[model samples]
Target: MQFDKPATTNPIDQLKVVGKPIHRLDGELKTTGRAMYAYEWHDKDVSYVYGYPIGAAIAKGKVKSIDASAAKKAPGVLTVVTTLDVGDLKKGKFNTAKLFGGSEIQHYHQAVAVVVAKTFEQARSAAALIKVDYEEQPGIFDLQAAMASAEKPDDSQEPDTAVGDFEAAFEAAPVTLSETYSTPDQSHSMMEPNASIAAWDGDALTVWTSSQMIDWWRTDLATTLGIDKEKIHLMSPFIGGGFGGKLFLRSDAVLAAFAAKAVGRPVKVALPRPFIANNTTHRPATIQRIRIGAERDGKITAIAHESWSGDLPGGGPETAVNQTRLLYAGANRMTAMRLATLDLPEGNAMRAPGEAPGLMALEIAIDEMAVKVGMDPIQFRIVNDTQVDPEKPERPFSHRDLIGCLERGSKAFGWDRRGAPGTRREGQWLVGMGVGAALRNNLVMPSGARVKLDKEGVVTVETDMTDIGTGSYTIIAQTAAEMLGVGIDKVAVQLGDSRFPVSAGSGGQFGANSATSGVYAACVKLREAVACKLGFDSEDVVFENGQVRSGNRSVPLAQAAADEGLVGEDTIKWGDLTKTHQQSTFGAHFVEVGVDVSTGETRIRRMLAVCAAGRILNPITARSQVIGAMTMGAGGALSEELAIDTRRGFFVNHDLAGYEVPVHADIPHQEVIFMDETDPMSSPMKAKGIGELGLCGVSAAIANAIYNATGIRVRHYPITLDKLIGELPDVA
Candidate 1:
């Protein structure tokens, strides 16, 4: 099914189930601890061995040698698989670094070997016995130190964008503001670590893993194993959590597969908590410099954003300047990104990626410019909002409600009550409020699904779409139920299996809309099949109450598939609609913060986000996603940072005990508002993604609020108490 033009009236327009606030269908299983995760899978008959991985100690070096003989002969160890044994295996397409089988170490904690044993304890004990000698070399570990050698990367979204003479425009402006902001590297820190259970039967291998993209993992696993793609099977129905860490193949799955093949039995491997941060990918730290020139009335005349980030060789930049090219209206604008070489693990996607950290700097710059021009922050943002792409004026937004989000959010958050900076005091605390605009690009991918209508009037939808605790199963069931005119109970959703039809997978907030759109297309095909089987005109047939009706003639839908289950398979292929028009999600974030007068400690009082992403598939699920993102944003603004050891060339705080995220005590009440909106060019569901949009600009709002509470502006992220104590006003 091709989506070439704007969508018109469809079954989803009925809003019977797809738009309802439906509870998660798998909620009970999760709460009861019945839903099996990767490490929890149990096979009744097959004996399973445990595999423990050994990671490289040096960040960059060549292996002198690895002696695994002691490990193999110790305890109940069966065999040992080392990178030296495999000798330069092919790297997976999605992986920026090699997962296994390499003598050269690119980063610290890279998998060097896996020791298989009858018990986990034995495997762990044996793994500790394995000795390794490495010839270490000095490597770049600090982004700021390596910035002088940074180079411009080659890619479509590699920044370096300009429309007009930004320098001249800025020089002529009446008011101008320039500032530099820094955001440190961040970890996914999801509840579930990378884990996998692999078993082999003859030439075929199957893996049960915690992954976000089943198809990507399957393909990459096959590539890493040097086997045919058909020989690999991957299943990841339920995930503990994956911000963006599990989007590609990880070490656990590959190591488990190798150990299983070596031992001739099923094997399981789980990366220890310590290995998760240094072994896997993390969000790269960034140094962003923003310059804004505005008229006396707060109209932005010139805007420029330049960012620098570090990554491994052949790696991409952090792309922290992407949102500046499109977020607000500026006649003369420039944005550029530079990539520096660093060996502190492979930097990759985390949550909203470019936009999340980008907005943390850009939105705050807008606030500072607003203060310089003597205008309200919200009004300044609203006045600069662009309906058309700022760089390409001919391409107008398909549907944008940035102003609506700002106005509505301001009212709900009581913006008028917000007093001057450092003026509003309540007892021992200074209170203030701040606002930031949210922007995330809407993305569409070709997604496929298979639908089956059983003779018992049951509808089943199957796709490789993953549910990373984002309520994917519930909303997918809703889409099927709404399209088939059946109760939600009559639909079953199967997901996260490579054997199923490929989908867009669950990253970039595109899963809900793209995967469900695939299901919608398949359901349409099933409806037509039912009409044909019942000898009714497919065009005139109305499916309602589990019956196919045409002009007073009605027949039970079960009659169409009484002999056997009817199956419909189709892929939703998108056209040039996305290219023809600018499609993006818009939202506004408002935050209230209280700063301790003497301690300079900041605490969030409340948070509200007004979003206009499109027609939300399910309000309950979308709201949950928003609040969770808000919590993460709070952590990023106040605590989260992957502290790097510049001399050691690795993240110093590798464990959760050292790294800090927001806990229940740190978060206050959170509120989310969804504007009434639908984009015809989006899809048949008319819904854009809201998950990533919820995280964007939230941290900036908190930063702005803290600045309001205390007259000190924090340019560095993780605005810890140490950074504020010096600038805070002296207390009585």
Candidate 2:
């Protein structure tokens, strides 16, 4: 099924099950601890060993030598495999740094060896026995020092774009504001660390891993291992969380597979908590400069955004200027990104990626510009709203309700009651409210699925789409149920198995719409097969209440199936619809904060997000994603930062205890409101992704709220108390 144009009335439009707030079917298994993770998978026929990885101590240079004799003779140690032993291994296409073999120490904590043993303790103990010497080399660790040498990233997804003469427009504008903002390197901090369990039978290998994109990992693993893709099978039915950390193949799976092949048994590997930050990908730190010029009447005339971040040689820029190019209407607009070579960990996607950090700076700049022009921030945004892309006016949005989101969110947040900064006092606390616009691109990918219809009128959907704790299983079941006209309980969902059809694989907020649309396509084929089996016209047949009906004739849906269940398979291929339409999700985030006058500490009083994404599939799960993202955004504004070890070139605070995320006590009330909307251009489900949309601009709302409460503008992220203390009035 090619979704080339806008969809008409489809089975999903019936809304019998797709839009309902249904409980997650895997809720019980997860809460009860019955769902097995990668390292916990048990197979009675196989004997499992433990593998502990040894990472490079230095950030850059070559390995001089490794003395592994002590580790080979250690008790319970099976074998030790080093990068030198494995020789050169090909890097995956999506990877900027090598995972395992032939490591020249591209970054800190690059795995150089793995020790396999009978137990985890033995493997760890054996790993400690192996010693290596490295020839250290000076590497660039500071973004500021390398900024002069930074060049425009040639491999960037979207290169620099310019519309009109931004310089002239900005110089001529009466009202203008210019500011610089900084965002620090941040970790995913997902509950489950990178883990994998690999087993081999004959020449074929199977790996159970904690991964977000199963097929991507499968393809990359084969490439990295130099083996046939058909010889490998990957599965990850459940994941604690990814946040984009587990989106690609990491060292844990590769080392585990290598150890399993060497030991002639299954091997499990899990990265210790401390290694997660430096060993895997992180959200890169960014330095952004934003200049906005507007009319005295609050219409934006010119906007320019430039951002620079450091990464490995082959890595791309952070793309912190993306939202600036499309978020508002401006005739003279420009956006550019540069990348510097740094010896830190590889930078990759996290949550909303570009938009998340981009908005942290862009939205705050918008708020500051609003104050300069003497206009309400909400009104300023509304006045500059554009239905078409600012850079490409010919490509209009499928549907945009940013104004609706802002107006609705402002009313609910009591924006009219907001007072001057540092004027609103509630006893010892200073109160204020702030708003920021949310924007994330709507992405669609080719996805496929297989559906089976049983003789007992049951439906089962199989796809490689992963849950990543985002409710993929529940939503897919809902889609199959809606299409087959069966109760959601009667539909079974099997996911994350390589044997199943390939799906969008859960990243960049495209999983829900793309994966469910794949199931919808499979169900369409099944409906046709059922109509033919029942001797009825496929176009006019109706599937309802587990019955197939055509005109006055009706029959049980199960009667159309043979003794064996009927299977249907199809892929949802996208054409030029996305190119023809500028598809994006929009929302507004509102935050009210209270600042302790004496301590300069900021606390969130309440939070609300108004979303105008296409039809929401499951409100319950979608709300969970929003509130969770809001909490993460709060952390980015108040606490989260990956401190750099300038001397050693690594993350200083690499563990969870040193890094601070919002706990339950730190978060107050949070409310999510989704506008009633549907976009035929999105898919047959008429739904766009809400996961990353919930996180897009939330951090800026907090920053804006803090500024409103204290009258202090903080350009740096994680607005610590020190940044506010000097500006606050003396307190008793």
Candidate 3:
């Protein structure tokens, strides 16, 4: 079913299930510990061997020699597969660094070998026996230091945007503000480590792994192994968390597959916590410069955003300037990205990739500009809001409610109560309030699914869509239930299997709408099939109460599938609607914070996010996504940083003890409100993604709140006490 045109009135329009606040359908399985994650999968038929990976000691060097004789003689050691034995393996398409680097190590802690044993403990213990002698070489590990000789990245998704004359307008403006902001490297630090179980029978390989994109991993795994794509089966039934960390195939799955094949037994591998930071992908640090020229009336006349980031060779820039090209109506605007070569763990997508760090700078710049002009920050944003894309005025937004969000959020947050900085003091606390506009593009992707109706009138939807704790299972089931005119309890959802129909695979904030639209397309085909089986006109058949009715005649849906289960498969093909119209989501984030007058410790008092992202499929899960992302954004603003030791070319803080994220105590009351709205062009479900939307401008809000409280502005991220302590007022 092609979604070439805007969605019309459909069964989902009934609003009986799709838009309701439904609890996660997989909640029970997850809470009861019945759901099996990759490392936990147990098969009675296959004797499981364990593989512990050994990482490179040197960041960049040639391996002089590897003494693995001690490991081979270790107790229960089945086999030890090293890069020397594997030779030159094909690199996966999505991988930037070689997974099993040996001769010349690309990065620190890159997996060089795997020791397989009868038990995990034995494999880990024997892995310590292997000794690798290396010749160390200097490598670039810092983004700012490498930017001097930076080159344009080869695989950048979006180059840059420019309009009119940004330099001239900025120079002519009487009121101007220019500032630089920095965001540090961040680890996904998902609860579950990268793990996989691989078993090969003859030429066929089956892997149960923890990944976001199952088919992408399958094809990449096959490519890495030099095997037939059709011969591999990948399954990821449940995931603890991804946040873009599991978007591609990791070393664990590939290493386990090869080790299992070598040992002639099924093997499971899980990367140890220490290796996770330096071995896998991370969100690259960025240094961004934002210049804004505004009139005395607080209208933005010129805006320019330039960002510098570092990644491995052949890797892409973070594209941190994307939202700046469209978020506001600046007559002269420009945005550019410069990429530097760094050997730090291959930088890649993490949550709201481009806009996350981008907005951290841009939004704070807006706040500073507003203060410079002696205007309200919200008013400044409203004065510059663009109904059409600022880069392409010919393209109008499908839906934009940023003004409404700010107005509503301001009222709810009591924005009028905010006073002058350092004026409102309670004991040793300086209290202030700040707000930022949230913006993220609404992307659409073609997705496919298969829906089956059994003889018992039960509906089952099959797609490779992953839940990833985003409630994909619950929302997909709700979509099918709404279409079939049945309760959600009657709908079963099957996901994360490559054998199932391909889906959008849960990335870029397009998964929810695209995957559910795929299910909607399949359900449309099923409705037609049911109509044909009941000898009724396909266009006029109505499905209700587990029965299909046409005119005065009705038949049980189960009767149509009495002999065999009915199947319907289709793909939701997109048209040029997205190109014709600038589709995007908008929101407002308000934060109230208290800064310690003496120590400069900032703590959030209250927070609120008002979103206008098409439709809300499940408010419960949508709110959860928003609050969770808000918490992550708080960490990104105040604490999270993957500190790199440039001399050693490795993340110094490799474990959770050093890499801090927000605990419950770090975050305060968070409220989320979704505007009552929907966009027909978004999808049949009329929904856009909220998972990443919640993260968009939250850091900026916190930073603005800090400025509001202290009258001191810090451009660098993780606004630590050290950065603020020196500039703070002297308290006697």
Q: After superposition, how far is residue 254 of candidate 3 from its true place, in Å?
A: 0.7
Give the clash total for candidate 1. Answer: 0
lDDT tens per residue, model 2, 237-315? 9999999999989999999999999999999999988789999999999999999999999898999999999999899
Each candidate structure's TM-score, on Cα atoms with residue i matched to residue i, is: 0.99, 0.99, 0.98
Among the numbered candidates, top lDDT falls to: 2
lDDT of each: 0.92, 0.92, 0.90
Segments of candidate 2 deviating more than 4 angstroms? 730-732
List the candidate 3 regions with Cα displacement exceeding 4 Å: none
TM-score of 1: 0.99
Per-residue lDDT over 133-164 for candidate 1, one digit per residue giving the tens place of the 0 to 100 score = 99999999988889999888876655598889
